[model samples]
Target chain A: MTRPDPESRRNPPGAHLGAGGSAYAFLFFPMAILTVFVLAPTIIGLGLSFFEWKGGPLWTGAGGWNLPTFVGLQHYRSLLSDPDIRHGLINTIAFVVGSVPISVLVAFVLAVAVNSPWFRGKALVRTLLFMPTIVSIVAVGFVWRWVLNDSAGILNWFLSLLGYNDPPNWLADGYWPLFWIVVVQIWRQIGFCLVLYLAALQAVSPSLYEAAAIDGATRLGSVRHITWPMVAPMTAFLMVTGVISALQVFDLVFIMTGENETRYTTVLNLEIFREFSYGSFGYAAAIGVLIFVITIAATALQLAAFGTRHPKAAGRAAK
Target chain B: MSREHRRRAANTFNRPPFAVRLASHIVVYTVAATMLIPFLWMVLTSLKTSGEANTPPSLSNLLPATPQWSNYATAWNVGGHVSLLDFYINSFMVAAITTVLAVAHNALAGFAFSKMRFRGKAPLFWATLLTMMLPAQVFFIFAYVLCSWIGYIDNIQALVVPFLASGFGVFYMRQAVTAVPDDLIDAGRVDGMHSFDIFWTIVRPIVWPGITALAIFTFMNSWNSFFWPLLVVDSMKMKTLPLAVADLASAAYFTDYPTTMAAATLLVLPLVILFFFMQRAFTQGIAMTGLKE
Candidate 1:
């Protein structure tokens, strides 16, 4: 019996010996699923934005469901005129603009403090800080709802003890609902940003800080000169991702406000849900398309502002 | 300010001022404590009787006079039409199946992207990466329509199927797979192992850490998924834990604080425990997903 060479055995007559062909075989399932679930729906959403679906699916008594009626640019025009959606857009922007900077700054401070050499039990502190991020957002919203209740909430209780007789209704009051929602969002998200900043901070070479100190720089000076510049890319990354997630914020606001109080906390996503529930599928798709466009534009802006290359690894060698 | 200067400076200035260190400690611990307040309150409120939970604002109201352990039972049994156990089963089934499928499919695709040469590989990978930038809400309207057309509305498949492939998972796994040395793959090929066989035996084991990270992430995200499940599932029988919790907190039962807290506690405790054991993996997974190269 002649032993076949390894290459011949690997590349048998019908086998996919070429790497490119084998890659196709490996990629077929995931690509198919992505196309159907993500890509196809995105395109369908764009198309649906032009057509009006006034009611739930009508069975045509034939084989299939009826298509929505076509009304080009009407939903888009209506979106511009709708006060609720206009407020929703403002609320969404308010959330992103309000939460991102506060969360990032607090997280940066926490990261710097926790990353200090003298900080004991750093792991424990980090874990405690990050605990909120792991909990379900709906649960967090509910818990916060109770905590922010005017009469019964512990926060109010504490405030009352501090000599304030009337504590504002954090979740129910005008504008306060949105304010508390942003606060809860920042609370939940700060840990994630802190962890990322910590990683980036640790990746910064100690010699840079040491060198700055030797040059008669203060701790704050060294942090400003060395640490901040080194972590700028991570900051840029966080800002972009943060703003995107914040723009799409739904769960916390929805669960906290319970789909009512549209005047206070209706975000763009909640508006989409409302439109969909009302069988305004076309309008919802239009809003969805708007969100997609804004997300892409924001991402493009970040890439333009920060450049594509991350300075993470490069910052280490500069020391 | 060079290395020699730094050595001298470090020897002379080895320690920071005590006040500054104390300030750092105070700042870190204060934030940590504030971060922990909600969790602490949840656990405490879960132990409170309904009356105590609803009591007027006072210092003593913060703690239950008598811990009502039965709140858990009530929350699990009588608080909702669907039993909490059923919700757990549904949640676990959806999350478990979704995690398995996501990890497996993502790992296979990541391996292809990293190890195998392919035409359009660059463009295809960038397309998939671009999908990560597209928020899930962008797909919500049409995903709902698609599910309705397919008759999956009010069905668990609506929750599980759309999420079976994650772009973030693929991106993270591809990064992990790229770190696997080429020599190892060549050696596996030399042994006449097929690509799938090589992936199962070699690549999978080498990237188990990444797989573990992705699995935890997928499970957590699926288990905590609120928006899509809310949109798709309307039947009480099909409600995931998050949806059920939301329902429990809504108008009909929002005033029932103990039962709601108990439900919240039940919803949170598992992930908390999971995070406890897998703390490093959990944090690393978040960093990996967010701070990709």
Candidate 2:
């Protein structure tokens, strides 16, 4: 038995459906763009993290890529030891972990509620749920910052009416900065999650619910057993995407948290921003690399345990 | 399955169901209000004078006491270097060019992936999906890099280039293409149509609506895009709506409420209008993607 050439089989020169080899170039566009924008830059980014780049133009290399300089372990060392980066990592994790569950659960309940007849003006409700999702994050963050302002802000004004003297220093205190960031993140995201959950719940078969009802399940019971399992894939997707987004959560955090200080409100993106803003390209890139590593590890662990929305064999097996 | 279970089920669902439903109505309405109030605030605030804006937002101020329509004009003209018209021009041109290129590339590649027997096709598609999972984090420098390499960074193309062949577009369009009957291609061939002709004259229209939805999404994303433009293009001359509006808001010392409102309202109105018109296509197109793939 002759072994087929694996290389030729995979690359079959100028391969096509019928016109053979004529369509081979079609692959080049998508593949080339990927190489240029994604693969090549990523490889370059991996290398640059080791060097000390004085951010000017990427090519001019104000320069530092050496071994004692290469300190095979130094980039990793700096990433771990940096207080701001460390705080950012923790904040990012907390933000994701905190938001994902609340958003997903609230959204799921809202979707189920909307799917029922008791919810009148469903159209208006849906539009309301979707508005924040469509609005720019900057707008949402900025507006909410005003509303959540410590003194003379809307929340505090209400608190004053309630006879409270003080409200939280939302963007100021180290603790509440983290708290406010989470609040904004969840506030902006809950609507989006609700929409996705609604869409998923819309796909749930009524027959299944009816069967659950006939089987003597309470409304809540059916929700727990029937609805929950059916929406698991979406829940998992929300979780994964939530985790992934939370890891890189930048915009609202940057805008809402105001600026970086000992507030420990900085995340990886902010850390990178600090580096880049101060012309510490390599150091920022190092932070980015760490983020990339964490993302991969986290996502892999998630996929291993939670079976993603990818309905292919891997997902099926994971389930 | 049992008599006891049946009795319990009947009692639970049948008892005070009207009251339960009424309570649900109140609960859902409150939840819905949470989502809707912000936009109501946006509209109300747009009508407000600078004085109203500093004070807490309230429904009583929903309609500005003395409605000032001039604020919109102020926003339009405040950044005199480029007016709303210029931003509109920039937005349309960028969105139009990006949508066309992205849809075209997606169509061709999606067609190939769906129909053609390419080497490593599965792996290639998988790689594309993987790219979608990669965070938008690393993209901070994509525009800058592409520009320095091609000297197009500050140019309008900077806004249009990097996203031209979107991964999700390809994934979606490929799902649409595979549903096209092979016999249709054979019939086209039997009618003496060229393959390119078949794709253009036959397949394009069938997928045109699907492509139209993709175009709108691409357009919206490109139109509202902030970060990439913030990094790549530094000049006020090339500002898109989001960038210009954000600048207007941030630069306002007294939080130039009226002008900023006008700019934001102008920027968002077209989208709101566009969304309403194509809302059905947009929703159906989105719905179909999940169903298909």
Candidate 3:
């Protein structure tokens, strides 16, 4: 309902003095956001990593943490040694490895399918396909949970219809927990990648494809020679964002897995949440710090590849 | 450019050529249908009563056996004590405030980066780019503790304040601002106007479209954010739509699937409406990113 501002007041303050002050004011809001949401928790997490408390600010120091004791790296040792944590870590990796490539592949196929002029109703199909992305992941999790419900659920009904006598416990079973979770994750994330790929595919210069056709090239030849290099940057961007987003994956896992504290889907962040819930603030902080460290290292490698110098060198190598 | 290439490619899929066209259409439609069934299922289930929902397997389950439209009213009423309407209000407020503030900050930052220069600008921009890769969860555990220390924990500020700064928004707006001509600002400068005047008079009006598109996405994000909100929001009073509806879904054990589906439908209404109204902006917003245009 808000109208566009009248010309008089709608204008930015270009003539205003003290660019630094205005800049500071501008920087203030965004920086404050990052400070509160990101930096502060990170600092507090470091302090908490060293101390042990049971559900409170009052540090008993019983765990040998400095608040009263010294439990140097004891939490880390326990976390490492615990088979559950080890299993959860493995599960998290299995999820990342399983979902990321497949989602990317599906997205690419969908993009190509919709991108080609050979098909009618591409608009309807693309919207329908991308529709899942906008739906709440939490909602999607619950819906899929119903679909996968072990008893009286649609999945089992369909499987039995297909002649399998028994459909395993979708949520409770240890076996396909990773599989179902990955399926939902891929479903939710595929839409974003599809949009990205579609954009990237369109950005590809058509003249190159035409030139390739003139050279007696096949569709595969055009994709290999022209399409691949053009969209490589977009692919690179998706990978970097995809990996980071994957490592931080929580909403679907949290909702799908539910309040079973001992569930196998717990990742590093979940471990931190669990530790905090258990009143071992220090240990939780350490786990968070460990996650941050690994993330930083991973992101650095990703950015380094995206850096012009490295890629240029690689391009030189290819030639 | 070459009829021969088209003909040669046609040979692989079809010796007759007309069959490939039909085959492609079949493949595309099949993929589309696979993608749409979940949404189709959600709406169909919403109209059914709790009793019908508890019943297993029936594509025959399409229409409610006994339609209970009252489920919408109850779902709205039962939503984690916050209720659907209230959650919508709270969500709208947070998203609105976040969008307004983020747009203002990014517009200013983008203008400065594009037009004004002091020192270390590229480095500062690069630093912001690097921050984009930060996994938010890595820092949130600490952020929670820090918020608690500052008495911001469980406060709506915890819900809203931290989301206003977005590096990608700034980056995108900066690109848009750069497309604004330097000569336009120069003409204003010759009129004895200052830099701020130039930004207000020339740049902002021109860049408002970009600002608007960014706002929609930002609003969508704020409306749907769960993880951090989950961390801070405990009271029913502060619950957002996703949190409230999710609570309904989680607790409904032998309860009616119809009611849960109704609840889910209501939850998504605001987004669907917003997207429908501004769909042109959203699509144009994405299409702009293709870069070749």
Candidate 4:
């Protein structure tokens, strides 16, 4: 709704001075940057994925138009055959499935709790819960890695005091590192989702709850019947964005599991980083394209699901 | 009805029971505390000695026996090869310049998209929106190639030039600009004010809060950014704070816990301070845009 309709706003020609020229002038720089850095690279990245190149010029020709280095579908075919790449892709999917739902659910619960009319310290709680989202991921990753250290970690030390003789290695043991990575990701994500949910929650009309109460609805009944449906748009938004981010997770996983090269914790972006570092440019671009395809597909699927159920909400989301 | 009576009528009658409210409070506080634990531990470890940092945690040993204030100094100048100060300077310069330029470019483009008529307006706006949705990962591979082609692989320009504009910034500012009343713009035009001048003097002030919010978000994002810097920055001299802190933590020769903690704390300190000062605008910025960097 904040987007003004361009067609309806057409004034008579020459009624506005400096409008036409300045519009182009204003758009020139950002659009140029986007065209070169974002638009062109995406097209080029797709092209690069089909060809084999290692850290240098694309082809041995006058312009890169010659098809000497072209290897059609080779990188994509290799991706299908490669075990490590498949595992990395599966890990990313699992990460998205594991983290996105839990984060959105937990954030909704917290937002609902803190948005209660009688809730004390709402602002304080909001501030505290939202802190982690704004901080440096590397710093937080290091702190968690230290706190979850096998022998010297505060977690194990706390576990020992609580009458447990053995606490599993959180970062080193099989599956535990992946599990903790998901947990840390959820911890980081809850705040942003919570803030969005809180904003959505505040916009709900109190009169609806009052009306439900008068109709013999309990607090739980009211929330289930009214509040849940109302925040569907926010939930949809959170899920799409959350899945997109969860699929591309790198910095935290890299920081936590880089020392061990844990197979379970390796996600798509990490694999992409590794390929790029190894000078496998075409293969890396192939993986990048895979991530893009998955991201677009997931976004489209969510929008379709939401559109069927909440058409207006889905329309907003499409923006 | 009196005003107070009207307000009382607006209150919902489905308030939870005392026990239920108490339980909800406990759950909320627990989650909030969970969010604070890592930060508190980071600060605590930074002040402790290496021996104390690695020591078993207990009620008595929670605080450092005597805070080692010098760990920060040690962390700042780790080895002849790596220095946190250099990383700090690199991060500040890049983030500051990027923030200023991004605000101007995004605002101007936002104004154009929102109010001005031009050729390719609809398609251009759609492309901008598409850029907002597309993950930055999609472009990284070829962006690297392009940067290298332009002879900027290891240069600081790699950090700033390609990233001087953002789809989110443009979109957010478009919303802000759209909210400005048409009368103000029309009046400025009547007085023969140029579009740029009107944007600067009239519209900018109206959306100053939004601008500040955008600026804060841009700064924090640039400061904390890792992936691009990781790709382009091959030398220690060009490393940003995130890269420097990650390197420091994972360095093969480095097992100094307190110093590592100190370095982590220093990396996170600026934004933490900035958040406390601009918490309102910052959170509002996130809520307004419904996006995170």
Candidate 5:
């Protein structure tokens, strides 16, 4: 047998570059834009967290806002004590903790059911499930708002017909506002998660199921022993992304709950918007930092818990 | 047993039982119907007259006695200070331009990371990936301040500029580009093609599917973006489709459900149409974003 070329083994053909300048040339534009837009703002946000800037711009010229005063964690300290911020933090956490697991589980089940060979019209089902994800959140908010409206809403009307005189006012009552918001969030999100789960499910080998079936394992037993473990990485991916977006929940709250209902609907992003609108820029930046911290910590915790293996890695290894 | 009988028995065991199939189909259709109810209601209500839409507690009110085709016209022309046409134009322009710029920038960066050799490439790539994990709200306040300082506040550029370089886009493109065969790049290099030339001529065509996926994702995201547009655009003339639809929904103290539904139906119609035509691409793009290789 002929041996493989050691030179080819050591250095892949495309791995070699004639000069370093070409690499920098390709990278310069994106790096510059990201640095300016994403990186600089992040660093500036962190710096802004320590300073107090009222009025308008930070300049001292005519028509300029007051100079930024160095407050050195004062904003952070006050945020810890602010009732509204505290409430906002709790609401944000509740939204994440409440929605992520439920959506993931629902998505997983749907994916499994759809992936079964006997399941018919799978494409149509997948499209219908994913329809909400493509629509604007604002549209979703409007549609659901009408659907859940107390007096003239379809849900309440259906409830009344069922012999209940009054159904709980979904968007108006205490706790129900948050409840409906989470429902809407999950509703929009399930499609995305379902598609992901389906992809992961498709990648799951059917041979494993055939083997399990030959061993006299029931469908539930096979799914429990094989499907659940196989889709763990996708679950982690969903969990981290879900928590990050949930922590930054704003559009649903803004459109669903509307203004002056912050007591029930305020999340950290809404709190930031409220503060920014009130010209509390520094305080808003502080809240922004807090959100950043919470997202990072939550993501880190998820990664630690689930291990950072890509689902596709398993597919590749199987091949 | 004989060979034919054994084969038939194996087939019987392979297929699910009739009861199981019935149960699964029942659950699946119910879930699909539940998922579709809001969309059905939105379309139904858009055809409803204002009175019918606001009518209290009646199954008859669910569908209009006569379709209110006028609601669409009214929603287009007189619903808000800026008509739905202007909002469509604004949304299209912003989303289109942002998609173009983001794709170009991310593709370039992806090409470099995937095909080139350079010092500090790993760190630079990791840095970009790190930003993906941070929520946009974390940097958006300072971004707002930056926009104001740059005189972009209340301007369309405010909606477009901050999104021109997306970390997710860069990461996605890098993954796609890395999967391109190295032999192709070498052949292009042997033909004396510059790296950019190779990227343009060879790599891009090879990775066109990835680019299409990214484009769909970016376009949908930009079109549906609400928070940044809401924060930056205070004027009536500058609102995107989402901001405009939201404004219409909240206008008139939320009394005009039909017109609001009309506005919403218009806003979502294009995407739904696009999704139907490109269901495979849409689902693939979504799944690609979620489960990175």
Candidate 6:
């Protein structure tokens, strides 16, 4: 496969799909879509972070356009001091900190459970578990809002049934709002993590377990020593991807939390949407830039941290 | 099953003790029930009257006194500016067109990337990978700016055109295409098939599962999309199902829990139903792609 094809050298880009103009034809639409929609806008967003533009045409004769003016580092400087952005940063962090470990841990356990030899109805249980991950987050968030309504919600009703007369308002009472938001986020995400972990566990070579068994290891010890190490790559992948998605969580927090309650649950993406709505285009772009940076940094930090313990897993995670 | 699949199945060890297996059953089933309760709640609430739905939970309140099957119809006409039917139609059209076009484009590009030799392929593929990691919000903000500048806001094209291709789709389809043997393509070339013809007849049939996965994903993303639609869709007529459902919560109908719940049910039911029929393709696709948004 590595040898260069001499026929192609004579035939000008070969006669397969790589035949000169036809290859470019195959690429044209995807390239144009990526360039115009994804690439150009990404560059424009990065450039817009350094300038103040109220989201309009670049230049015009009669001031109809909101021309961008160079603001240097002012947007970034203000983001450091802005309370809302700070709260958003904190909430975003709180979500990442709260959701990733809990979901990954729960998913790991469930994956182990379902992958066990004695597990029954495996396909049905997996299908039901994975159902939530596929549904619309916005719709589910609305359902959760109904379920968590302070007065008449089913959750508080269930809590009352559990012997607490005064259960905290799941949607509005201070930290409980973010708590439930994080919980729902975990609920929605666990299935995804579960599926990935299941795949990883299924891929583990049974010979490793047999070797551990020959070494006189107990089941628990074998799990800790063999199963855990085998799935480390998937764990790293889940954590990295989980953090990136959790950072941009918008639908749940937006729909579940009330208008004034955004202080507790507003994520960075919500802040971006809010700021964009308020005509602070540059600031919104700056927040997006912040998310982009944090996503990269968090991924790198995870890969590095995982590298120390599981270098092979860390290498795969980087890909 | 394939030999590889059989080997993996053989990896399972002996059954645990009765107590251990029972405990695993309880834990797994309990978590599964917890996952499903909200969906059950959504469907049940949609069938209840406002009075019943508004009250605290009880065994009686759990089931509607008389199922208000017309709540779906009520939610349909409750959209002040546009009916729920319009939203469904809009969402359906946008998702359908976007999925069809995106799958085609992604397959073509994936085949080229995996099999074809061309100039600048390395850099272009790298650029595609770079965009895969970028947060959609970054591109979205500038996309909003660009759309407004080009007067694409409130236009359905804004919804369909931008999403007609994605880096993940192309990258995923590339992986699928990479799994096909080179001998197959060479055989086609030796048979005097044109490049596009070979791609259409040979490469496409081989990578259909990958295409189905990409199509389902693209459709779900487009159908459930809220953020981009929120930004670009100004008029009520252009609102998709998700946007319409979200609006129901903020609209005057917010207190009408049954109707709102019904609308939310309408929004969620299609994908769930589609998923049920296409379960294997959906799950296998995710495992194959090894990533999700």
For B1-293, candidate 6 gives per-residue lDDT tens digits of: 57665445444443557898899899999999989998898889889988888788887678998999999888888866678889899999999999999999989999889888888999999988887887787788888777887888999989999887889988998999888887688877878888888889988999999899889999988988877898899888888888888887667345788888888888888999999999999888887777875
What would the per-residue lDDT of candidate 1 be over residues A1-319, giving only the tens digit for each residue?
A: 5677787566553233245377788788788778788888787778888998854466867647776899999999998999988899899989988999899989998888787766788899889989888899988988888888766788877777788878777777789999988998899888989999988886776667666666787777666667777888889889988887888888888888866856668889988888888988889889988887887787798887677444543454255
lDDT of 1 by residue, B1-293 (tens): 58776455543433578898888889888888989998788888889877788787576567888899998998888544568899999999999999998899999999888877657889889878877766576566777777887888998789888888877878888999988876678778778888888889988999998899899988998999888888888888998998887787674355688888888999998899999999999888777666421
User: Where does model 6 sit among the CAPRI classes?
Assistant: medium
User: Candidate 4 docking: what grade?
Assistant: medium
TM-score of each: 0.92, 0.85, 0.85, 0.93, 0.93, 0.94
Ranking by lDDT: 6, 4, 5, 1, 3, 2
Pairs in steric clash, model 4:
none
Model 1: how far residue B177 lies from native, Å: 0.5
How are the candidates ranked when ordered by DockQ, highest leading? 4, 6, 5, 1, 3, 2
In CAPRI terms, where does candidate 5 land? Answer: medium
- DockQ list for all candidates: 0.49, 0.29, 0.32, 0.65, 0.56, 0.61
Instruction: Name the lDDT value of residue A40 in candidate 1.
Output: 80
- Write down the lDDT that model 4 would get: 0.83
**Native contacts retained, all candidates in order:** 0.53, 0.18, 0.40, 0.63, 0.65, 0.63
Q: Candidate 4 at residue B233, lDDT?
A: 89
lDDT score, candidate 6, position B32: 97
**Each candidate's chain A: what TM-score?**
0.88, 0.83, 0.81, 0.89, 0.89, 0.91
Which candidate gets the maximum TM-score versus the true structure? 6
Chain B TM-score, candidate 6? 0.93
In the range A1-319, model 3's lDDT, one tens digit per residue, is 4554464244432433235465555556666666566655555556656666443333336744324245777877776787766766676677777888788877776676667755567666666666676667777777777777776466777787799967778888775666888998887767667777887886665555555555667776555555666666776767666766677667778877764534467666677667666756667666666666766776688778667544664353233
Q: Is 4 or 5 the stronger prediction by DockQ? A: 4
Instruction: In model 6, state the lDDT of residue A244.
Output: 87
Per-residue CA lDDT of candidate 4, range B1-293, in tens? 57565356545464578998999999999999989988888888889988887777888889999989999988888857667778899999999999999999999999888878777889999999888766667688878888887888778999999888999899999999999987788878778888888899989999999999999989988999988998898988888989888887788214688888888899888998999989899888888888886
TM (B chain), model 4: 0.94
